[model samples]
Target chain A: EAGVAQSPRYKIIEKRQSVAFWCNPISGHATLYWYQQILGQGPKLLIQFQNNGVVDDSQLPKDRFSAERLKGVDSTLKIQPAKLEDSAVYLCASSLGQRVFTDTQYFGPGTRLTVL
Target chain B: GQQVMQIPQYQHVQEGEDFTTYCNSSTTLSNIQWYKQRPGGHPVFLIQLVKSGEVKKQKRLTFQFGEAKKNSSLHITATQTTDVGTYFCAGADTNAGKSTFGDGTTLTVKP
Candidate 1:
């Protein structure tokens, strides 16, 4: 059983530039999530997907951030016109999509984005 | 909006000392999960508590869910250098799908 995998362990971009991050979740997992973890803060849920359909994205910045899980196995999160404030770690997590009692999320090594 | 708060953002102790971190939620939680993230590493699931006043132990680590189901605590006994990391508590709402995580408590052990 392989763990969740993410690409580009680290990234650096200038303000107003665009950046994208990719994630491949664990096999057979049905729930995928993207979270933003600012330094010294907890990871904030940006979006959640269940089988290629979005379950929740209320916290996502519609104006600048977007994410998609086209085939339900992999996901990509993009930020256009990135701002310096967007510098944070992007963490991708996957779960079995069970009830809260049994749903334990496994996280991937996050992509640390540094916007200058 | 729901909020989970953790106290004592940071703790430093000797290798033989014990340490504890507390998590409190603004609303009742149906279940709570704990994760540990070492420096420069991703969060790994530690444990989950569902029933009220449930207690579970793993080696030297102990987790407890409050009787009110709105608070939780993680206690580590005789901490070692390997115990250094940030511990986070996430509370799952009645909806069963949504969860909110606390800022986390970072523990540092000095040998």
Candidate 2:
């Protein structure tokens, strides 16, 4: 079986510019997540979706960041008026369900974003 | 908010030597999962521990969950070049599968 897939493996933009990242999770995986991983740091959860509904998004920066999982299988994360600090890798992961331990998130080769 | 601290931040090991990384969580975790990321690759799940004071081993890699469920450890015996990468320990937040990853420990193996 194929793993979670993400597009635009890399992205470069200037501060104040808008950028978006796309992800396609594994088939039948009902749980999807978006995370931001700065260089030399761990991935931080930005948002989570169960099927088409959002389960959590407390960490999201509503000011300039937004994400959506329209059909539930694929999702997109966007950043508008990007800041220098927003230069980081955007990662997408998927799991079988919301159960702790039973749900092992499978990550994709994140989209590395660099804002100048 | 939950936070996981990984020790050593970075480790350089000679091939055939042993390597170990520790992770501590600020809050009790229902479970802990480990992942490894190659220099330019994505994070791959290594293992998960759900029981308190649990120890699981896969070949030379041994993972341990603390009895208090707030700490964990990963030990790699006789490390090799293939073990080069960053090891991360993530705690499953109370929000279920939502995981908060630790600042990974980058391991460099000198051949």
Q: What is the C-alpha lDDT of each candidate?
A: 0.95, 0.92
- Tell me the tens digit of each residue's lDDT in model 1 across B1-95: 78999998999999999999999999899999999999999999999999999999999999999999999999999999999999999998875
lDDT tens digits by residue: candidate 2, B24-105: 9988898999999999988999999999999999999999999999999999999999999999999876754456899999
Per-residue lDDT, model 2, residue A75, is: 98
Q: Could you tell me every candidate's TM-score relative to the true structure?
A: 0.98, 0.96
Q: Pick the candidate with the highest lDDT.
A: 1
Q: How well does candidate 2 score on lDDT at residue B29?
A: 90
Best by DockQ: 1
